[model samples]
Target: MKKYLIPLLAISLIWGCKKEVKKADESKEIMTTEDEGWTYLFDGKSFDGWHTYLQDTISSQWQIEDGVMFYKPDPDKNQGMNNLITDKTYKNYELSLDWKISVDGNSGVFYGVLEDKKFVVPYMTAPEIQIRDYTNIPDFTDKQQMSGAIFGIVGIEKDVANKAGEWNHFLIRIDHDKNQGSVILNDQEVAKFPVNGEAWEALVENSKFKDWEGFGITQNGHIGLQDHAHGVWFRNIKIKEL
Candidate 1:
């Protein structure tokens, strides 16, 4: 009886040790630090941390469908109809997303947006990376208005936007410490401009955003998307703090 009991205890101890080892191995796989600095603002699943620019709730025009944040047109809505904004504020960071527009569609990705209800247009408070279907949108006169442009402030010399209905990638980096901002489209550097430098001041002075106090101020604010009264889809929205 003693001999049998001794063997059973040894077997149990060995099994316990094996289980512990297995747990350790599993934890190594599950606990990863790959996304430590990156925060997934959108995972193509839900609009959990986003809302309209100044409103607490999301607008009916903005919809999450087929794993994309899309804007559906509504003729009755006002100028600021289709804007959506991030719930949290970010100071300096790198943001990335992909966008595709319908025929003749127009949209924009904006940053440094101040959440003031008094600001009628989102562009007044934030600088934008323009997105539009250049080929189909006849009124899209400026190459800077094509895609990856800093909207009215800066322009891309060449067209980098994919054809309408196809996805185009955008990467925007803002460094508040250096007061610099840069944009990349399809892995190519399209625009690089200083935030508070003479060039930026000139841009602000000439543009309609001049009068706004918070215009082009990159201290800390929410990211925004323009509605533009057309169908547009955005996905894979992610950001990393710098």
Candidate 2:
């Protein structure tokens, strides 16, 4: 009986060691993937890498509270074009962020945003990912204009957005190498379209951006956030260059 007990104890010790080793390996793998070419656009402390479109500074309406970057509208002040954009430019990359809108609020995320004086607004040059609380918008049946749509250029494949005031995640990938741009909303692939060439041209031609000369013409540009006079919150903004 003593001999059998000794063998059983030894076996238990070996099994424990093996389990510990497996856990350590899994933790290492997770760290490696998170650090692999990914960068945080917002550090949750301040708006260090962002500024207003066409302006050199950030607007007072855009506030950083706790860890969220949000728009706080001033009823007394006349807010004119307070759109925020990144300081640096990105050509082909994967962008990830979380956003929440007020009840019946509207906003958007833009890419390929040109800051030239000729373009008065970011939408003039960039393509927008429409963001809105469609569930709260009465009688708004236009899926092309809803959240996760490519703003009138392309509609989303599904509507999986959370209700107003609830958080929704977006993983947007723009790959010029593959000539494809995609939007993954709440881990669901909602939209996909061409970023350049004839297919892109056709998409633009059929959309409202057909007359805008700089719209989606350049694959490299700044990313922008719309200030559509509605309350919106953003956080966990990061990017990975592909």
Candidate 3:
């Protein structure tokens, strides 16, 4: 009986070691994939995987030229008219892009955007990171309307934008577990905030987003670009899931 007991304990220990080794191998695989880095959201030559917000086709005003997806605003057009969005959905991620706005142009990068056309447009479901010519754009009077702001929710301190026609880089990191997010401009940290939590709750409590159900939920949704009747170019748009 004693000999049989010893053998049984040895077998159990061996099985446990095997299971541990298998788990370690699986973890290594996951880490390797993560280290592979960001996937391109835009292919630089086509809008093959993108569409108009809540629409099946890209708008006539949006085009890809000189290897950049650009919003060509018509002088005859009105404000807040066009929007472009990615075909895929993303949750927690680090999104990076290069953007340049025309003189007095206003645009934005939006995420956590659920595609719903129940209203006149899909922007009602998402929060925006404002992109504007801070020194040249006359409409915005506050820092929150500047290039790196979380548009109306939080303001960024630095004026990190390149001149009106030069390209500027932006990085946005969204962490769903911590219920927080941040924005960086030209490799500098600009703004940070909590999402769907107390800080966000306070901001939404009295803002226009108060009654919106899907606003700032941040589970999985499209990436979007605002077309505020001005020429804006974007390139090298990429993301890595956190």
The estimated TM-scores of all candidates read: 0.81, 0.87, 0.79
Candidate order (lDDT): 2, 1, 3
Residue-level lDDT tens digits of model 3 in 1-242: 99999999999999999999999999999978865788888888888878887678777788888779998876776556578888898888899999999887789999888887664555677789988875554455587878898887788887677878899999999877878789999899999987677778898776767887777765678888998888899998889888
Runs in model 2 deviating more than 4 A are 1-29
lDDT of each residue in 1-242, candidate 2, tens digit only: 99999999999999999999999999999999887888999999999989999888887889998899999889876564899999999999999999999988889999888899998889889999999886655788788888899999999767889999999999999988889899999989999999999999999999888988888987889999998889999999999999
How does residue 112 of candidate 1 score in lDDT?
84
RMSD of each: 5.2, 3.8, 11.7
Q: Which window of 10 residues has the lowest lDDT sum in candidate 1?
A: 29-38
Sort the predicted structures by TM-score, highest score first: 2, 1, 3
lDDT for each residue of candidate 1 in 1-242, tens digit (9 for 90 to 100)? 99999999999999999999999988886655545677889978788888877677777777787788888887777655648888998888999888899888888998888888778767778898888786655666676677888888788877767898999888899888888899898888888887777778898888766887878875688899997887899998989999
The segments of candidate 1 whose C-alpha lies over 4 angstroms from its true place after superposition are 1-36, 76-79, 137-141
Report, for every candidate in turn, its global Cα lDDT versus the true structure.
0.83, 0.91, 0.83
Model 1: lDDT equals 0.83
TM-score-better candidate, 2 vs 3: 2
Off by over 4 Å in 3: 1-35, 76-79, 137-141
Q: Give the Å shift of residue 42 in candidate 1.
A: 1.1
Query: Which candidate, 2 or 3, would have the higher lDDT against the true structure?
Result: 2
